[model samples]
Target chain A: MDIIASKLFFTGIDIGSTMSKAAVVDAEGVMLGYVIGPTGAEHRRRANMVMEDVLAKCGVSLDEIAYIISTGYGRVNVPFADKQVTELTCHARGVAALFPDVRTAIDIGGQDAKVLKIKNGKLVDFLTNDKCAAGTGRFLEVAAETLGLELNEMGRISLQSDTPVKINSLCTIFAQQEIIASLSEGKPLPDILAGVYIAIATRVVKLARQLKVEPPVVFTGGVAKNGGMVKAIEAVLGMPVSVPPEPLITGCLGAAILARDEAFKLINRGEYKLQKKQLSEAYIEFTEKTR
Target chain B: MSGYYLGIDIGSVGSKAVVIDGSRIISSAVIPSGTNYATTSAAVKAEVLKLAGLKEGDITASAATGIGGRNAGAGSYHSVILCDARGVNLTFPAARSIIDIGGQGSQLTSINETGQVIDFSVSEICATGSARLLQVVARILQIGIEEIGPLSMKAVRPSNFSTSCTVFLETEVITRISQGDKPADILAGIHRSIAEKISGMARGVALNPEVAVIGGGALDIGLILAIEEKLGMKALVPENPRIIAALGAALIARG
Candidate 1:
């Protein structure tokens, strides 16, 4: 028995479509460390390795971690998690932790898009578009490819569209064509960039309306770092949007907090409804009985 | 004597047949492409006959445009025509840019003031402009092609799809769907992608206000909106946009 492993901590892992993230927190809900890795083709296998590496890097042992929670698009694939939470709930909790007064959370992930309405740090209503990646980080990446601009450069370049063309078309393919047409027309590069920003901002605003969009809106996900998009969104909403530091990691942090809470609940009760799956003989007997 | 002409545009995905009496289209028919061009042509012929009714036999001549433009001949050689500057100029005399987007590919032609093909761009590699991509989305979401447009209009928070390439986009769409996005929003993303690609192709061409859009894909409201939004100018779409190319061909034959 290692003494270092005896310390108490809670862990949260978010298995996303493109990447995986892990976070650890103490019993007091104070986050200590975080780690991120690619969620390659082998999702579940990669998740385990990522979690193990995160624990090692954070100088925390598996024995010290009281509970493990999983979140994100691939949450269900996390075999080691004690509980799985929806990205919606986790994003709200994460934003709430960062910005206690945050009433709205806009999370644009790699493969999906989400908008959360938060009241008192709790999720009220949320809208998400997981059917296509037309307006998300992925779409921006694709559009950037046509312009031969790097992902980071798109926001800066988009700020350049002089006319600030409106791309009302909801489809990514149509948008691509429209962009090509603009390029052929010799429209200034900045104007095209500005147009893209407005399009994305318009999409977010449209979704934000579905939920009660109150001020003090917090933006998360990889797209939050796009200053052009941020300004565009602000201009559309006619208000300042707050962005949490490390917005992408908030989901993992929230998961860690929840894990810490679970651990504390178990410590005080001294009685964990033992996860039946942990008992080999009892699990077999239960399965046999059910069958 | 005022003479009328008929035009037939048989493309890979669909067929458009139109009868032009001077500048106005007397009748038009749009039908899906079956197994082969012959079958599709036959279908178009039947549909045209049905639409033209009494005027069907009176059509003095006919022309063909698009991929099968060279071979779209009925029994009569005097009635047949092919896609060219003369064909396009017959109907859209002032057209500066003629955009044709069908199910399989897209064509962008720049016509000078004299109604000549000055420069043109074609997209044959990327499946972005094809209906196959939309078809895949519809199948996965269990919706029809027509539903994609209206559903996309309802997207509160539309999803973003990167990758103008069709194969890559299909994977992205699947990932989004599994992530729990609305199908309508997803469809919107697909439309935007196509518009972006088409817009890129036309980037360098000096755009003339008298733009003419003719293709089967023109029926998709989402795609048209994307073009309009990006160009920042309203383009004229004939009543039956899909049959415009055919009308242009027929008008040429009438001459």
Candidate 2:
């Protein structure tokens, strides 16, 4: 966190559409520390803040981290990253590290949803709903707000319903209307909440089905923390789905692991050089077009 | 059975009712659709009947349309698209194309000379290009929906939005506000994006001349102007645009 921050460490920064996260790993890809927070309006500044927060939490100094890799939609905005890897690739590596046999991985993040096909631990091919909010965290957030309930409360509450209502709208806003209509129709709150998750699961599972989902499927991303999503997705997929212990940190951990691999690979070739990154809030000039 | 005919459109955002005696529309009512569609339907129906100086017993037949059409307590419900074509033709005899942009979505219907449907298309649920976003923006900006049109008209250079998704556009507007952009400029940008999306959807159908724009979205002058600019032509609007589908329902009831 400070100038004298020393020791050999690698880091991964994932500045996603909604949340910005950072993870630090030792030479063996063991996570030393990580930080997660809302991306807020200013991502460039948030990127530097997340990196410093993770390092501070780990008691590591700025100079101790040997390499840093950035991923996710806002990856390009991380000035301190030694390299930028696509989130899908990072996800594949991260999930493989967690579940070695995972052949399919689906991540429903804040704005976009993706289904990644993996071979062993590397990404094969993928499909994404990046341009829309049909089956993503945004859908759940909208539903939560409409129901006048906390976002975290929905998952557990949805488990109580035996009959989830049918939701037809795929658009997040239109789906909110459907939720309202369901509320008006005297549908139980649990049923409506369960239906919301089912709607998202239906869309994402449909995407997964398009790829002929191989078993050992793992789900990650912040949305994976929701129990309702896990249940709905499993039901829709007609197969069990596994979630990592800390699903939200997988992308950043993957980046950290990738950084470690990259650092070691470079050291073996006598090409290991730490990127000179000053983690400071000095550059506030370019907030525009950062996203 | 020959007293008067009534048509009610219980839409997602609003419920509208039209009362007609013979071929002439006597009165109409528009009200916000609250949590209960049936409740709002009754209110709208009562208001229209009262405005027309008629009682429930005087109504010969009634029909309903829109998303909550079935709950309107009418004789029967008709498809909104069919009602739209019928209503728009009645409002504007020369109109061969109808662009109905509601609160939550948009629809484009092309009709024949005799008011028979030729072809029609509905915008994707996410691609509504409707007033729903405007209402949200208005709330975020702490202004009335009525103020958006005049407020957006003052922008010298409208902010150029990069995304079409309403959620992303909303974030963009917030970002712009934080960056010290004027509300007018941001509103102009929002209108531009909405117009671009609506016009794009309209183009997917067999667009014909004398295009009539209706529904809650037509009430936004800024959106209407921007849509006209995007389509490169003037769009005709009725005096009361929200009840086009209701009028169509009324005509169907009359028959």
Candidate 3:
């Protein structure tokens, strides 16, 4: 029992623009518990809260966490993070763990969207829409607010429309005005919602198509939970996409996997004095070679 | 016998109707263009006629311009660029360039000495720099759109807004708000961003001296200043910028 207690346990924290997530995994890379919460103005505090929540859920203490890896927009701000990795790399690794055959990954988050091309569980190329939030979860949120619908309810309502209304404006503000005009024209709510989904899908598809995105694609991030978006993306891509059970935590999960791998390497090297540090050369080499 | 000519410009954001008796403007009305374009056009026409103390049948000719102009039930329709150029020329005779930023889109037209449009360019597919974006930002900031121009003038250090995409601008604005940025600074940043985008579009046109800024978006004094700072030249704005297009349409009706 004492030996088991002393065994290495890896933790990963992802502090995103809208939410922070933490995942715990054992030496075997099996997830023990995960926690997610809104990331308010204070990112460091939110990261700590998520970490503590996940550690408590897994019945593990802070000291028991052999290594802590952080990822996402606020990755560098994690006080206890042992290593900081980019969300793009984390998402690729996380999706590869769940779907070994995934050749492409599309992650639509609160304020950005990314499309990754993977080959044999490694990231080969990627594209990101960091300049704008046109096709991201924020766009959907604005549309939902305009229609007086809950974020989670958008997918279901959108699926009910037989013919989606055309949203001509690419700008969100203009799109809102268009939606208002459509409503006043007696267009059904479902049709307007469908139009919003299609608009997002169209923009995302254009981003994905920039790379050689092949089938066996995986969708990750909070937006992956939107069924209407999933359907719209699938229809645009003309192929089915695999979504992980916990899509929102994939970045954290990837960080956990990286932490577990690092812990094993340290043990093999007979370096018991574990100290919080930046990413190791081996990990950098691994990511570089994959690219 | 002298006759009255009516011009209606039904824009995406608002509608305007102007009545001109031969030489000078008599009455004009501006109202929010709701869902139904035909209804708003009819309403503005009636209001303008009432203000002029004349009947609709008293008008000799009528012309319409703008996005909904074709559906305005007018006798003739003119291109928005042409009307804008004529309207600006009427006020500022030496005006050689015009930047008309409307609700749904924007246009930059280069005119000759006679106010004939020589070259023109328009925003392709985005409305990020138009009046609609300002209205949306005002809603998000919980202030009236009319206040943004004045409030922005007080900004000592305007923040930087990188993206011209309205969708991304919203996130940036929210982030800035959360970061405790002053509303005046944010509004200044927005005006700067809009000016930058408009400048980018204006580069394709042969912009000369005596640039006249018109349309509903010209009401933002901060934006006008930003434009002047961006283009490195002063601009001429009329008393009621929103009525310029309608006035131009009325002039074309007289012809």
| TM-scores for candidates 1 onward, in order | 0.56, 0.77, 0.76
Query: Residue B162 CA error for candidate 3 (Å)?
Result: 4.6
Query: Per-residue lDDT of A142-228 in model 3, one digit per residue for the tens?
Result: 788767789999899889997999887766666766786677666898898888888888899899999977989999889899898
Q: Which whole-number lDDT from 0 to 100 does residue A277 have in model 1?
A: 33
| Pairs clashing within candidate 3 | none
Residues B157-248, candidate 1, lDDT per residue (tens digit)? 66798666554565567668756788778887777777777777786666677776666666777767767787777766655667666766
Better of 2 and 3 by DockQ: 2
Docking class of 3: acceptable
- Maximum-DockQ candidate: 2
lDDT by residue (tens digit), candidate 1, A172-258? 655665665566455677787788878877777788878868878898888888878888888887888998777678889888888
Worst lDDT window (10 residues) for model 1 chain A?
A: A279-288
Predicted candidate 2 versus true structure: per-residue lDDT over A102-149, tens digit per residue: 999999999888999999698999999867787989889888877788
Error (Å) of candidate 3 at residue A181 is 7.9
- Against the correct fold, how does model 3 do in TM-score? 0.76
